[model samples]
Target: MKKIAMTVFLSTAMILTLPISSHAGHANHQPQESKELLYQDMLMLFLLPHIDQAVHDFYAKQLTASPVVYPYQVEVKKAERVGGSRSFHFLITLETTPVVGPHIPVGTDRLRFEIDPTLPGQVKLIQFEHLKSHELPPRWRHMIRRPEAIR
Candidate 1:
């Protein structure tokens, strides 16, 4: 009789602990779904541009001229939707060549671009701060015109 009572008690404890363990496993996975949703929203709103092909081609030429300073990868760090516009803050990592001495590699020129959805394919280079450009890339300079300059 004692043995039966001991087995029942152990089974009940194991069943109760199983749910707690399962819940913890589920909690860790929930955030991944939310992040994926956010990424989808960003792609739909900000990155769905046909003109990106031209932009990529332009960047390629610019990088060839100044490989050490030009950004190798442009990653959208954050995308926020506001009214009819979406603000995309990008992190541009400029790939620096390996130094001969004890020089450490560094990245500069982080750019933020704000695009208005209402204007269709119109993208405003809202803020180009933190950049030290001697001359704007020919493709971008010729393609994207400044809002202020438009008469």
Candidate 2:
């Protein structure tokens, strides 16, 4: 009878503590809005420093025979949450220069950033696809061939 009473009392105490502990645990948790804002700030800051390096590396890797240097720009095309993961897509353009050859025409690529859920505010580059300048829209294609056309 004593053992049964002790077990019942312990179970009751454990159950009573669960709610209090859970509430306390959640007390310091930030709302999703603030968490997302933090994530965005982290993402922007992380990408800004690495964009130039990534562009240079891509060119060096893709064109091993002749290392070419071209003015490059990265434009964030979109950022969206798909399923449980956040994704950032960027249009990377390496503008044509006076010395650009037929083989190394104006370069364009789609850079994709897949958020690493485990790392919270970090991202992994999932794709870096080379896009032909001709594949773009007519106006964009023209702009690639003649950059001054738009300006």
Error of 1 at 81 (Å): 1.4
List model 2 lDDT by residue over 1-151, tens digit each.
9999999999999998885434345567865678755665565556644444555555543332332333333445667665554454332222222113443444555666665455445556666665643233443342243343212
Residue by residue across 63-143, what tens digits does model 1's lDDT show?
332122222234445556555444543322211221111222212334445555545455544443333333333443442
Candidate 1 residue 12 C-alpha distance from true site, Å: 50
Off by over 4 Å in 1: 1-72, 84-106, 131-151
Residue 118's lDDT in candidate 1: 49
